[model samples]
Target: MLKLMSLEIRKHKLTGLIKGVLIANLIILGFMVLVLFVDQNEQVSTFTSFGDVFEGLFVFVKAVFIIFASALLGRLVIEEYRSNTISLLFMYPIPRKKLLTAKLIIVFLFTFCTIIISDLVLGALLFWINHFLQIIPGQLTWILVKDELVKLGTGALYAAGIGLIPLYFGMRKKSISATIISSVVLVTLISGGFDQARLGNFAAISISLGLIGIAIAYVSIRKIETDDIT
Candidate 1:
């Protein structure tokens, strides 16, 4: 599995995916900075805890990660089918199920790790900015860190897990545009509804989506078993 994942990583090294992720992170940082300039009378000005700040930032984080996952799915899965390169992959000695599993794992790990690290860095920077600029009126504390850390961990997994939904659609339709579009729609609907409906908790929403993604992944794996690679 590790070897297969390594092969997957090498396949994408020259595809500009890494560069795109970096650029996205920079954009996220800029968004965080803009939050600093929110008017004093704005709703954002009322945040008084690191938890609130993290939640606010996560809205953007979730959107960004969802888009990132879509791109990865398009490149890794849909492109293979469109270009007829997945047939070549099927020629390998590995079972079709194992091969597909490896690809899914790569997407999950890459998306999960990137979001966690980016969120941590963004959180730290927000804390620093708030400490000096008093933009959000929050003080960073060890307890706050501990609390947010748990949320960050779960959120990262949730983001990664949700990518499998697009993976399923991409594999089933073999359409790159379809995969990306589905992700965008899913993110907008889930995030927007969760916020407007005053859902139980973001974590619960993430978990629910994660479970759905897992189910889709399972169906995808079963699919490739009978799917024609040609």
Candidate 2:
């Protein structure tokens, strides 16, 4: 199963997709930073702090991620069922839960890793620009780097939490198209709540909720049998 999974990944070139996403995110961040730099003044409005800048970028990028992922996963499930390849998936001796579990793991892990990589690139660019502009005049310190790393990692995890719903969609219904559409609608309606993630205690609550999303997806996947996959 693992080997087949690897083949599945290779066939799809999921890594390439992640790389494309990272590059796209970097491009978007670059444009945003350019705009902000042009608009900067002695009295910086909302964009005063490094945290605010980063958070603003995150909110924008994650909105794209959330919308695209929901539709992508929804379509992923829908296509599998529509194409009837799910029938082949059940041919192996593996339990249906294990198969679904593998797919869920692959999907969310890919989502999380891609997001983290994008943030890391964004952080690096931010620090470079700050240093170049002499905005943060000081020696390069490890603590600052560590803080950025933490934010990147934690922020990615939080984003992934919201994205895991795509896995649930794929698990419960094989129509990727429908799942993606529904996921997009849901994200649009609920994004306002998570948009406050930069505020106090929101990160912790978000991370906790992300774990819950994973748990729910696992439970949903476990309830079905191999035959039902068809």
Candidate 3:
């Protein structure tokens, strides 16, 4: 599987995506700074504490990378099928399922790892900025850091699974636009909320949606051999 993944990465020239991710992170950091600035101008505090800042960081990371995953999926899977280029891959000696699975794994791992690393880096940077600006009140304690780390890990795990949900829509229409748009809709639904209550904050809902994404991946791989690429 690793071998196939390596080949897929090279074959698709996915290294470019790494650069794209970096650029995206930088943009996000700028947005975070803007948010802090906005918070200062308002009478009500948008981020009352470090915990709230971390939560905002998670929401942004999750929403951005999930869309990134879908775009990757569109390029890796949906576009191939749409162009009938996947038929050439199926002719290779490797099993069709393995070929497809390798692509999905790349998307999943990329989404999961990027969110964790980006969150930590951005969180640290935000902390430093806050130190000078005094934008948010409260001391950053070890206990809070530890708790945020836990939240980051579990959130990344759930996001990795949720990232695959777009595959269901992508496969249905064999359209890259459909794939990305579906992901946007999914992210909005999860991240949207009334005040402090977000749908994604509910552990049960996250778990359920994540399971649905995983099941979609399984079914997609199972039917790969039978799918017509001609």
Q: Give me the candidate number with maximum lDDT.
A: 3
Among residues 3 or more apart in sequence or in different chains, the pairs in candidate 1 whose N, CA or C atoms overlap within 3 Å are: none
Error of 2 at 221 (Å): 1.8
TM-scores of the models, in the given order?
A: 0.90, 0.76, 0.97
Better of 1 and 2 by lDDT: 1
Name the TM-score of candidate 1. Answer: 0.90
Task: Give the alpha carbon lDDT tens digit for every residue of 1-230 in model 3.
Answer: 99999988998899998899999999999998898889888898788888988899899999999999999999999988877888888999999999999999999999999999999999999999887888877889999999999999999999999999999999997999999999999999999996569999999999899889999999999998887766
lDDT on C-alpha atoms for all candidate structures: 0.78, 0.63, 0.93
lDDT of 1 by residue, 127-229 (tens): 7777777776646678888987887788778878887788767766788888998999888766665433633155577789888888888888888888876
Q: Report the CA-based lDDT of candidate 2 relative to the real structure.
A: 0.63
Q: In model 3, which runs have C-alpha deviations exceeding 4 angstroms? A: none
